[model samples]
Target: MTLYARYSELLDTVLDTLQADGTLPDGIERRAVAVEPPRDPAHGDLATNAAMVLAKQARTNPRALAEAIAPGLEALPDVSSVEIAGPGFINLRLTDDAWRGELATILREGDSYGRSDAGGNERVNIEYVSANPTGPLHLGHCRGAVVGDALARVLEAAGFRVTKEYYVNDAGGQVDTLARSVHLRYREALGADIGEIPEGMYPGDYLVPIGTSLAAEFGDEYAEAPESEWLELFRTRAVAAMLDFIRHDLATLGIHHDVFASEAALQAEGAVDAGLERLRSKGLIYEGVLEAPKGQTPEDWEPVELTLFKSTEFGDDQDRPMKKSDGSWTYFGSDAAYHLRKAESADHLVNIWGADHAGTVKRVQSAVKALTDGRVDLDVKLVQMVRLFRAGEPVKMSKRGGTFVTLADMVEEVGKDVVRFIMLTRRADAPLDFDFAKVVEASKDNPVFYVQYAHARVRSLVRKAADAGVSLDAPADLSLLDAEELALVKLAAQYPRTVESAAMAHEPHRIAFYLYDLAAAFHALWNRGNDDPGRRFLVDDNPELSRARLELALGIGQIIRSGLDLMGVEAAEEMR
Candidate 1:
């Protein structure tokens, strides 16, 4: 358990004592009680709102309830003093030994320091980066990929059984266009002058290899055949080839999904029909003409009867369609079915989609809730776009990607670690500016370099300590650490809570924000030695103090490595 968790348990015991002695009421819910660091460090090490939240239930004012709880808290061995400030908030200053014990725990746990079982091994299925197979993954898909993958890592660290998934939209109209585009390329490969790529086809040259392979395999058998003879065959081959291309690009950035569910396979096996039938049995599906979109008159709109799902009953703005007038499933219908299939195996479902899909979130969420009879919940995280720049100038589109900068392009230029770390520097729903010159720059403004440099400095301290004959292998007397050094331990000890909170909120960007603050504190300590030689991590006269300081530095480095591992970034040991 972490220092904070240990104290939280103690606070619970104190509350229990109050109830046992008839000072407070019995059977009151204590779930609202929280023990955390005070807003201001000067207030105290820890503060709790047990009185503030329980005052009403206790039939007393907050101050009166606080008066009853203070003595119980003061009796704890680790607490040196307890003060009630402003509106009956109870703050406690822990003994220095308490902080020292936490530092020792950091060294003892090492890489496993921040890991926890807060998730209780619940099954969570996260589907992300399900880009269409028509082209390479662009910058729009990159942000969602990083956010989803990092979230998976964080959830696993918090003890959830996570399944990383990718949904292939191979059964869509775009893949048909892809087949036509590849057929044109195949004709060009067969010594035919197909001229420039037409207006409606994929214009990138990435498909040239797939066409060439088809020409080399089948010769001219399908070259002169009609579209009916080879459209499905070519679409199958083209989508498979594009999936391979996508997998290679995703692997470059260290992303690999555990499950790749195919929309085409789902439809081929009649899952969509089965899912719709289940909804029909629940009275959520029916053949009805949707009213004209809001703000339009009935005379101006042509309404057609279609198979619709009662999405509005479950909180959606309007009912959603399951099939078109032509009796084919709409995109939302297929997606809803896919979610139903996923929910059958997992306890919870999460979708990471681009911001462009924000309008569809409510409908899909309602579909999941209705389909599962309120048994499962769906969380949709919408990722904003990433704009690329080169030295402050807007970057031109990639020729290979046809319109946008490809994921492979970004990963190849700035490296995988830099790409992963910088992508998360902002919230996933906020626009991010990525400059080639800025991300690779070795400056404090760059979080990737700043965090990595802190870890590298810790490693450099070890090498310097070895050369100066300062032994670090001996047991560290943590009591030798002063207030300045112990302050760092206080910051590093929040890692466990940080992981648990970030995982619970489904916000992986919190880890990035926390790492930057921790690194800043460490750098401030490293810079302190420049003014006084005695403050240096390696003391020429007092080797014992030097070893204790080294222990502090190593503990910080261990935390940095663990956070970077969760982000899928490497901790640099040395800088060039």
Candidate 2:
């Protein structure tokens, strides 16, 4: 158990005791009670709202309830003091030995220190970076990819069976456009001087290789044939080739999905029909005409009777169309079918989509709820766009990708670690500026560098300690660590709690944010050592103190490495 969790259990025992002894009434809901470090460190090591949450149920004022509860907490081992302050909030102060023992726990657990079973091994299917196979992945997909991948890692660490998934929209019209685009490139490869790509066609040169390969394989067989003869053939081959390209791009960023659910395959198996039938059995599927969209002129809006799903019954703003008047499945219909397929295998489903799809979230969620009969839940995380910049100027589009900077270009320009780390420096729904110059800058302002530097400095310190004849295997007295060093240990001890909360919240960015703060704290301690030699981690004249401090430094390094691993980033031993 984490330090916070241990205290939380003890706090729960205290509350239970209060009820059993008649100091507080029974059957009070303690779910709202939380045990966490105080907002200001000066106040306490840990704080709980047990008294505040239970006072009304106990038929007593919060302050009186807190006073009745304080005695139980004060009796716990390692809890040196417990103070009730400000409207009955209980603040706890533990002995310095508690923080030192946490550091020892860090070293003992090492890389596995923050692992938790909070998820109870529930199955989670996370679909992310499901970009169309028409082109290379862009910066927008990059952000979602990192966020999704990192969340999967965090969830796994928190004991969830997570399936990293990608949905291929190959059944859409976009792939047909891709076929026409590839055909143009094929014709050009076969010696046609195709100048200036058409406005509606993809103009990127990345398709040139696919066309050249097709020309070599089939010669002129489909070159002069009609569109019908080669459209399916080209679409199949082009999507496959583009998928290869996308896989390579994702590999550069260290992303690999365990499952790639294809829309074409789903339709081929009649999943859409089956999904709609399931909803129909529940009376959710109906044929109706939707009212004209908001602000539409009555004459301009011609309502057509379409097959619809009663999404509003499940909390959507309106019923969603499952099929067009001509019987073609709507995007929502196929998407809902895909979700049903996932929910069949997984206990929960999560979709990481661009912010542009925000309006569609509710309908998809409703579909999942209706399809699963509330047995499963769908969590859609919308990631906003990323703006690329060089220094302070906006970066231009990629010639190879045609419209925007490709994920490959960004990964190649900087590195996989930098790309992954910086992409998660903000919340998924917030706009991120991928400043090429700023991310690579070796300064505190750059979170990637700052966090990596903290790890690297610890490595350098260890090497320097070894070179100075300090015995690394020596068991040191942890009591030698001072208040500032113990404070860093306190910060490091929160990793497990952070992992649990981040996993439960489905927010991997919390890990990144926590890592940066931990790094900042470590860096602040390092800076202090420069001014006071006695405070330095390596004290050449005092080997005993150095060994104790070395233990502290190594514990910090272990946390940095573990946290970076969760983010799919490397703990750098040396920075260039």
Candidate 3:
């Protein structure tokens, strides 16, 4: 029922014909061959990379291979023409009927048009926005969270078994600092006048709830104890409180993770030790000293011996230390083991990280390679900065003094839907500018509102059509649809193919852009009707044309619904 996907079957048929006709070399691998939209629309509706991919292995000129592939394709029903352009790309132009038939499929499949099985139920783990438990998530974490969540949704739509995960940095110096901050709050909760927060203590008032709860539960007993007595327990309580607040903030944007892996748990059962031993068996662990890292050489850059992981054995610039001189594991040490643990259960691993950790990419990937010995694929997506704005003015930050905005604060101001949709309007690696004023406007400039408006418009069209007594026969004549009506139908048919591409490329922003384009096309068609009375969705005494156009509009509406669902944006039947 998926129009674009069905063409892939036709593509397979062409390959089979080539093999059977003895035109192509024997033992051709079909898996490497792909069908996609040509970058230049003038080339064709779709282009395949098969010719170039098979050229080296088959020992044949790519153009000749493309020539052989074209004849087989030209014989297909939907393929109007197949041309070999520049190198060996095979371009296919579908017939008008072929494009028109896509609308039929949209009505049949509804919102599920673009779902693909490219993943074949394989297990995929996506770790993202593993922000520290120290404070509320802010604009820094927003883009990665939206990107990761949307990517998981797209992958699942493509038939992959995806697990959304959050790695909590609970057992670390940050958490210890968090404990000290709460101890201050605990003292304040007992009505003590705590002076200005110490230089090293966390200054956020977020931990006040933890203190108030402690006083209510354990009473003055724990309050009277020394710092050591309540620090760990308070740290645990504060982290739980922080996580709950974080999860609630994420839910506002409809984000959810299947797993919440704690770094402490990896250390609890000696999993970190076990992971290091596995690397040791592979001759990838040793005790040594590392050279000074890039940029500033720490004043304490004395060449000191420590147990180091042989990340250099894979691709790291230098051996990285697993333990500092004092015997405590460094952040990189826990991260290496964490990835190893993930690699064990996934066919593929994807981690979404903040821009600040760009340097950590090589070490984590190296550890993953060491653990899986290159069997598992690991991809780390680094998110660039977000330039938060409101009506063209830059938003300032330094929220420790209340200068910046928190994630919850943004959601509270703009609402969750606007915040999520605007975040995805740009790629994760590219810098994104989120404007609070622009995103919530009802005008066409707001992509989120524009796309949602298309849905609401279509929904209203369907209800009006029914009220006008339009009845669709058992099988309407699709060929009778006008050119404008047919064009909208063709757009509806491409939903499935778009989903497949977005997932395969690991690009969720593509979905956002695609939905905007689809919405634009549909809206343009609607406005055309308004400009020409005869072509309007509701024409006077032209029941047949109106019925035909209504069906086309319905198909477009269904596709818009499907695309918005994939992007985790609501397909509003009506907008506020």
**Per-prediction TM-score:** 0.98, 0.97, 0.94
Clashing pairs in 1: none
Q: Name the better of 2 and 3 by TM-score.
A: 2
Write down the lDDT that model 3 would get.
Answer: 0.82
Task: State the number of backbone clashes in model 1.
Answer: 0
Report the number of clashing residue pairs per model: 0, 0, 1
lDDT of 1 by residue, 1-576 (tens): 767778889999999998999878999888889888898999999999999999999999999999999998999988999999988899999899988888888989988899988889999999999999999988889899999999999999998999999999999899999999999889889999998888889989899999999999999999889999999999999999999999999999899999999999999999999989989999999889997877758675788999999999999988999998898999999998999999998988989999999999999999999889988899999999898899999988854348777899899988999999998999999999999999988999999999999999999999999998988677978798989999998999889989999898899999999999999999999998999999988889988999999999999999999999999999999977
Model 2: CA > 4 A from native: 25-27, 298-300, 398-403
Candidate ranking under lDDT, highest first, comes to: 2, 1, 3
Q: How would you encode candidate 2's per-residue C-alpha lDDT over 1-52 as one tens digit per residue?
A: 7888889899999888887989877787888999998999999999999889
After superposition on all C-alphas, the RMSD of every candidate to the true structure, in Å, is 1.5, 1.6, 2.1
lDDT of 3 by residue, 1-576 (tens): 355556778888877777788776678777778777787777877789889988877789899888877887888887888899889999988887876667666677766677878779988899998999888888889888989998999999998999899999998988999888887788789898889888877787777887888778877777668877887788889899899989987887889899999999888878788887888898877888777667988886788888888888788888888888898888888887888888778888998998888988998888888888898888888899888888999887775564567888888998776787888888888898888888888998899899999889888887887788876765556676877666566556667777878887888888889888889988888898666898777676877777767778788778777777777777788876
Q: lDDT of each model, Cα atoms only? A: 0.92, 0.92, 0.82
| Model 3, runs deviating above 4 Å | 49-60, 86-88, 293-299
